[model samples]
Target: MAASETPLRLSDRAGAQAFVQNLLAVMSELESALGRESDGVRAGRIAEAMTGAAAKADLAAAYTTGLETAKANAIALARFAPEGLEALKTAQRRFAAVLETNQQVLATARTVSEELIKALAEEVGKAHTPTVYGRPSHSPSPYGRAGANSGPLILSRSL
Candidate 1:
């Protein structure tokens, strides 16, 4: 028979397993038949054909089982719908918004603190100066020079 004219066979895990089992049974039957045959050449040829067919069936069975396992894994992954991804995206957007707000508040606080320090330094400059070793000296403001102090300290007082 021509290769194209032959019927195509497809098998899954269970079908492949069944095919392998049936092929083994057929091989046993063929061996028994060959033993009964009187012509040695015909018997040897039949045994060789049976062996080749069994090997092909075994290879096909392995391929089918591998395909079935891959199909099952793909199906399991598909079970996670788009909704899960959408929920994760929504959470990420909310987190981004919160982070942006925190950054804005920090920037505003930094600007206000800088202005407060500038105003305090100007006030201190206008205050009285002490004499140290016959030279003029003044008590340094906790805010330091123009750009010093690491950060502002928040002190709480109970009313």
Candidate 2:
């Protein structure tokens, strides 16, 4: 019932055409879901991005099942739905492109979040470190000193 979903008729008579068409519909809907998530994350609409996650998961599962079924009956698909198979290939290529974009968007968001947390951690570290002449006691690289004690940046759970 999603925007890109086409109702499926999975009867034996429907055959390859039905499978290919339904798979395409699922692929399209999944792409739409990913695009919405990417756009929402880019615009800082995090909640909106997550709203259709369950639906996306469902689409992904359906797509996976369709692929498995089609692979098992590749001969049937090739013989009965050659055109549909070609269309599916084209759709799959386009879907791959969308997935790449979605990954890049998510990676960018993760990098920005890590940077923000690092900045906050550094600020907190500064407040606690001993200082001399308006400079922190611990230099950027503490490896020079013998037995220098440095530890990983551990943010509090309260953050």
- Say which candidate scores most in lDDT: 2
lDDT of 1 by residue, 1-159 (tens): 235643324234454344434434543443343333323223333344344456545544544453344344333323433333344335436545544554465456558657987887655644445567977565576866532422454433221
Local distance difference test scores for all models: 0.44, 0.81
Per-prediction TM-score, please? Answer: 0.31, 0.77
Error of 2 at 80 (Å): 0.5
How far does residue 68 in candidate 2 sit from its true spot (Å)?
Answer: 0.7
Instruction: Write candidate 2's Cα lDDT for 34-98 as tens digits.
Output: 99999999998877788899999999999887877777777777777889889999999999999
